[model samples]
Target: MAELKEARVPDIGDDKDVPVIELLVQPGDTVKKDQGLVTLESDKATMEVPAPFDGIVRELKVKIGDELSEGSVVALIEPAAAAPAGDAKPVAPPPQPSPASGGGSEVAAKAAIPATPAPATAAPTAAVVETPTRSPPVAFDADALMPGKVPHASPAVRLFARELGVDLAQLSGSARAGRITKEDVQAFVKAALAGGGAPRASGGGGGLDLIPWPKVDFAKFGAIESKPLSRIQKLSGANLARNWAMIPHVTQHDDADITEMEAFRKKGEENKDTKVTPLVFLIKAVVAALKKYPNFNASLDGDNLVLKQYFHIGIAVDTPDGLVVPVIRDADRKGLLELAKELGEISAKARDKKLSSADMQGGCFSISSLGGIGGTGFTPIINAPEVAILGVSRSAMKPVWNGKEFAPRLVLPMSLSYDHRVIDGAAAARFTAYLAQVLGDLRRLLL
Candidate 1:
């Protein structure tokens, strides 16, 4: 015999009249014990009300924006048959990829030089991939009547919506149970800017007064097919767009003579356990430079600059899903061999989609190496919070005058992109010059 029960909100401290922000389950959905039924948001934080027992949801008593107290009923549930033992183990969700603050590239652990950072290039297609995925419209209902209701969304999505000057109440979510996602907010902005939907609020954080993106019918001229961006691409695109628009970027280009450094690396490769790549050296060099120029290790915090005393370098790794940056904490303390080993481990984790949020945070500086893929020079974007990013290009042999005679020396191109507001032209020049000088001599890295 099945048992019928009511799932009610548990004691949520002294908070009262909390608004329902998300519905985690739909009617007829089977849920496990302690599974979230509905999400409630107060001023401080958001929390989920759980099911008292394993059961199937019968009905939802509340909707998005509905106010509920501690004793408020969330749903009617019917206890179901015990789940199979095989279902006891929980499966982990795939890791979502985040954007690096530079031209995106894969980090190769053992390559002679760092892999180059480049924009994601699309393969040749018959037509463009520009279709917008939208949810089915809701007919006249409670949502229609409550135009100013609070939206059912995550904190990150809410922040993104606010940045785009979007009123979430006016938008319909395309996610499960009508919950909103980053992609949903992006689609809404696209439609509004293309003159297909309501105009967004003016003077919002990201509300730039610009002409609408031109709508084109590519099929009218030739064969066409619609391809949507992957979840990683969509999310990364949003952040990149925001960073590009908000930051005043300037690129300082220079070349380092790495003839002796390369020879040393090659010599060290004879010992398999102590092998090192140019990137490991670059990490140490960057840390040394940051110690020399403390401003490079700081972030712009409104009116104040917050300088970080520790060294954690972000290395961008390309995965099948997208580019993700995993940070190497305390880079200043790690030796070349240790950094190389950790880089290998981090790169493997990134590709396997096993990187956690902590693996990507607390980076004071970032290095995007594009040495594997040949390029003379390119500008890398500054990842926000951090004010500067270093870009490494392929190294080439060039003739140099060594006082009396010309000699062929290996030269590596380096590009440093910084927030102009924080870094001046002369400072950037000196930083690059100092970095180049350090790279030119292997002994400088020891100091």
Candidate 2:
């Protein structure tokens, strides 16, 4: 009789109570040795717990949303006997996060170095003759993927097309049974380029003035596969593109000394009615700053500047689908605990795909916090209609000279990106400085 084996979470460096984001296997599934059982996501990385040996899963020890750490049991397995010598190896290498890619599966990560474009070669006659009439490129359409009418292609091929911004509906596949492949997409792009079908510059009606996006056959260099962008990605991609192109953005960088505040937060963490997070404090501090600098809380509407009296703050939540900013209404009226509770609820709703349009609209300012995720600083894009957005990165202890001698201080990095048309550099600098001051002393929020 095969002995029962426990599949436990391996050493997941320094991450405690990481949430189980996905389950890769079921209790009844027959899993190979080293096959992933469950996926855990921490602030720094996402990793999967693997089966210790080839086995039939008897029971899952953990479920989604369960907090797990190193040595935490994931599943119970009944080990399988040794395989025959002539059998092919069934062990799959564990997926490792690609250092170069911001965040995605290993298969989604494109080559770090650009694969040299396949030399100019004569295309298959069908590929050249079947090119679809290229539409005049304008702003990226959020619904351009045309979910209503999908093309005949593998998920990997579809993903490749999406990455290249190639509309699959238009392409004619040369493959068997009218199936579109990566090669087909590549050929369509080459034909479009050779035919001078590149999109016209934004604000310029003249068509085909810009160089077409590059077409490359990644398979020539090495192994490759594609992963489709989430639905949120499709929508957000178009909006982000429009915002980046239309807005004249300026970023102001500053640091906040939060040594005392951090200490206070930790001390109060155990006593808070609803768990108080750094983000709760940020929301309060931002409200205070907005009150002092009311212009930052206003939006530009055609020729008018609409100043909002009620404080609604948009918190950029990183959901598995994509990034969604849900508004916390009347943030000025809510206490820290209330804000914290609401933040938690809204974030949960975002991740669960439960947020409505109203949940995202009517924001005076937006905050994108990457503090939980490790980052020194990043210029966050200003969510449109909101004139400014605050980006918070991970805090670190650093030596700071306090009048006489250097003292170790916890410093939080902030990047404030503002619409240059609405906010001047001096005002932007002043706004950040005041925000930092408020964050340094949470007491300032009371005033």
Question: Ten residues in a row with the worst lDDT in model 1?
Answer: 105-114
User: Per-residue lDDT for 287-387 in model 1, tens only?
Assistant: 98999999999998867999998999999787888778899999999888899999989999999989999999999999999998889999888877899
Instruction: Give the winner by lDDT.
Output: 1
Across 344-415, the per-residue lDDT of candidate 2 in tens digits comes to: 999999999999999999999999999998899998998998899999999999999999999999999999
Model 1 residue pairs with clashes: 106-318, 114-371, 115-369, 115-370, 116-369, 116-370
Q: Which predicted model would earn the best TM-score? A: 1
Task: List candidate 1 segments past 4 Å from native.
Answer: 1-205
The residue-level lDDT of candidate 2 at 15 comes to 94
The clash count for each model shown is 6, 0
Model 2 lDDT, residue 153, Cα:
61
